[model samples]
Target: MTHVAIIGGGPGGYEAALVAAQLGAQVTLVDSDGIGGSAVLTDCVPSKTLIATAEVMADLEVADELGITVHDAEGDVAKRTTVDLGKVNRRVLSLARAQSHDIAERLDRDGIRRVAGRGRLDGTRSVVATLDDGSEERIEADTVLVATGAAPRTLPTAQPDGERILTWEQVYDLEERPEHLIVVGSGVTGAEFAGAYNALGLEVTLVSSRDRVLPGEDPDAAEVLEEVFKRRGMTVLGKSRMASVTRDGDRVTVALEDGREVVGSHCLLALGSVPNTADMGLEEAGVTLGKGGFIEVDRVSRTSVQGVYAAGDCTGVFMLASVAAMQGRIAMWHALGDAVSPLDLSIVSSNVFTAPEIATVGCSQKAVDEGEIEVEQVMLPLATNARAKMQGVQEGFVKMFCRPGTGIVVGGVVVAPRASELIHALSIAVAEKLTVDDLALTFTVYPSMSGSVAEAARRLHHVR
Candidate 1:
């Protein structure tokens, strides 16, 4: 029987542990944090939960435009706007903790041993874990999986005290709503948080080093988001990089690279993530690391060392939970000598949980624009969409990319509420290698947001 030791309890580690255990491998999971890792307990779940409240706030704000009115308890016009940050924080933390406990319970039920500690590899086949009680336990394993996830990268100038200048994960602990939020970095995380906080009635300023928001996403999508943010009364400072963040009594000031300054109640550093690959004896084991400090892994999730593997954010392969889970499963399958296929990123769908969520899969406009891929593209505005018009949604678009010759649907992007759910169909099509003709023939309900998706695919049918 193979004994497997999995490091980190994030999506990658837990998923791999489950698969290995089911494959009859004795698995021991070592985690310094909670069972669900940062993705569940801190970053992804908490932020999305907070965004849920922000979404409700956004809907209420738009109710007046939708010919809807609410009366207060006294039967007068509803003129009050308030946010119970305490309640919101309570609910968010409660949900996160519940989910974490559920995961831990499931792992225990599956017969996988969970060790609460920081783990380090002593050798190729041995792991040493320092327990919470200051005791160290060494375990021998036939295989070791390093899923140690990443953390938010902080700047020397803009340090996170975890109170005022915070990381994305730390903001969930706030008892009071920020009067103004200055989010540094205009990447996906930064943009999403900025949009969410703006929806929640905080004066938001998105400081970006680039000329536009979402610098790495589709240009068209970024353009649309920038426009929407402006319309929503957000202050977007382009080409404005954060030099440092300083707190003065109650107010926090962000000094920009260009000498311009902005003040806010709190500042968030959404700069980027650094892989948790340090002090793990990876160097001694001869496991290679990439230039960016992530583990060097192939599609099969194998590091350079024998009987060892790595996955998730540590592998630097998209840093998404879904992708991490897939990679973990694949690693287990391969290690157990079962039927295994290499990781395929082509059809993997991802989403930014912003106000108008950005969900996408397969090829992108940047790829097409750079002539990296030969594809025909079609972009359809949600304002013209029947369901969108009826729902008073004026900002969003569904864009599709197809093979120019065969009209095979290669990729797509959806920017609107619940786009995350809607993109699954597109993901299936891309993964199944279905053509635009196939998508056009598929039935989508009329007077629905998804109708725009079908129509966008249908329009790509004529590009040949």
Candidate 2:
């Protein structure tokens, strides 16, 4: 049996371990930060769980619109609801820990050896793990999968004190919500947190270095979100680069490069991420390191060295946990002599867990604009959908892109509540190369937000 060694315990590492073990390979997973890595332990799971609570808060805000009144202890109608930060944080951490425990249990059931340590490549086919007890163990493997994930990037001029200023992972430790929260960076992380805090009834100021929030996403979707944010009284500082963040007593201030400063009760830096690839002996083992210190891997997850692979954030590919899991599985299939398909990023679906979430799959608008791919497009407003109207959702839309000649769905985007779930059918269409007509003919439940997806496809079908 092939012996597989996976370093790091994130989605990429754990997922690969399971596939390797199931394929009759002896698998050993070495991790220092528990079995779920940052995803389950701190980043993805914790953040999303917190967002779930924030989502409920947002729903309650519209209860009156739905003719639902919340009564207080005195039998008077309550004008607003309040959040208990301590309780919310406890629930978030609890859910994250529960998920990590479950993942560990699954790995144990699969008979995959779990080593508690920091692992590094000793050579092309060897892993040396330094345990917490100051002992070391060496494992011989036929294949090595490196899935060390990433951490939040910090700037020298604006450092996190872990008190008034915090990283995305550190936010869960807050026992009190800020009166005015200033979020630096306008990427997915920044946007999601700003939106969540705003929904939770906290005053928020979003500092964006770019002209718009979520510059990497669809412009139309970003525009809609920005409009909603501004409408809801979020102070969006567009085209404003943060020079530094300093805390004076209880007040934290963010200084912009343009000589303007914004003060808040707390600050969050969501600039980007830095891969955890230092001192791993990767280059010594003939695994090439690319720009920003990310591991260089091919479509099948192989590094430059034979029998060595890298996946997930360390590879600098799409940072989504789903993509990381897929890369890990692909690496195992290839290493174990099983049939394997290279990673196709275009079909990977991703969602930004903000209010009126933005989800997308396949080719993006930038590609079309750059003449990289020609396609027909149709966008339908969700406001026209019966269910959206019933739910009092006035924002969001569904947009579809298809080949002009063949009508094959190439890409699609959804902007609505639970857009993440709504993008699955479109993801399947893009993955299977299904035509717009095929999507249009598929049965959809009436009075549903998903109906907008079919409607958009139907319009695209007619355009071709």
Candidate 3:
């Protein structure tokens, strides 16, 4: 039987082990962190759980319009809605731990050897695992997969003290709600946290170095979210670059490059991530490293070495959990000589979990603006949708792009409640290369947000 050595137990590593084992390979997974890695233990799962709690609070804000109201012991209407963050944090951590344990059980059932140690490539075909006791285990395999993942990026000037100043991963340890939160980034992570906390009844201030929040996302979507943030009483400081973060007692202060300062009860540094690839003997084994120490891999997840492959955040390809899993699966299929297709990032759908979420797949508005891809487009505001109005959702829209002549769907963007769920149909359209006519003819539940998706596609059909 072929032996597969996998490093790190994130989605990329564990998912690969399952596929390799099912394909009749002996798999030894060297995962120093618990099963599911940061995606489950701290980053994705935990943050999304917290965001779910925030969504509930946001819904209550529109309760009056929905003919709903909360009552106190005396049967009087309650004016303020508050969240028990202590309870919410506990629940978030519990769910994360449960998911990690579930992944562990699955891997055990597959008969994959799990090691609790740090692993690094010793050469082209060997992995060296350093256990907690300082002992080492050398794993020899026909193929090796590097999926060590990444850590929250921090700087010397804006270090997280894990208390008043914290990284996104450290926020779960908090037992109480903060008086004010200063999120020092306006990207996905920063915007999510700011929106979540603001919805949860905390004063929030989002600091952005750029002209607007979510500079990486669609401009119209970003504009809607920023407007919602301001309407919800959250302070958004755009064009303000962060210089440093310092905590003085219970209060934290954020210093901007312009010498201005903002004080808050706590600070969150969403400065992005750095791939965990150093000291891993990757280069020593002839594997190439890209900018920021990320592993350099091809479409099939192959490293420079013949038998070595890499995936996940370590590769810095999209930095998304779903993409990581796809990369790992592709790696195993290719390594095992099975029928394999290269990773197609264009068809992959991604979402920002902020209230009034932003989801996108395939082509981007930037590509069209820069004349990278030519297409006909249609955008329909959710406010005009019957379901959106019924649900008191006034923000967000559905936009679709298609070939001018063939009318084939190339991309789409949905910015609305549960946009993540709504983007899947469009993802299929893009993947299958379905034309606007195909989507327009499809049935979408009437008086639903999905109707707007189909309606937009219908409008695009007229381009031909």
lDDT of 3 by residue, 1-464 (tens): 99999999999999999999999999999999899999999899999999999998887767778888664656433244567899999999999999999999999999999999999988789999999999999999999999999999999999888989999999999999899999999999999999999988889999999999999999989999999999988999999999999888998999999999999999999999999999999999999999999999999999999999998999999899999999999999999989999999999899999999999999999999999999999889998999999999979999899988899899999999999999999999999999989999999898899999889988877543
Better of 1 and 2 by lDDT: 2
Per-candidate RMSD, Å: 2.2, 2.0, 1.9
In candidate 2, what are the lDDT values of residues 1-464, reduced to their tens digit? 78999999999999999999989999999999988899998899999998998888767656668988764666333234678887999999999999999999999999999999999999899999999999999999999999999999999988999989999989999999798999999999999999999888889999999999999999999999999889877999999999999999999999999999999999999999999999999999989999999998999999999999998999999999998999999999999988999999989999999988999999998898999999999889997999998998879999999998899999999999999999999999999999989999999999899999999988877553
For candidate 3, the lDDT comes to: 0.93
Worst 10 residues of 1 by lDDT: 70-79
Model 1 agreement with the true structure over 379-422: per-residue lDDT tens digits: 88898888887777868999988887888789999999899999
Runs in model 3 deviating more than 4 A are 71-80
Clashing residue pairs for model 1: none
Candidate 1 wrong stretches, greater than 4 Å? 70-79, 462-464
Count of steric clashes across candidates, in order: 0, 0, 0
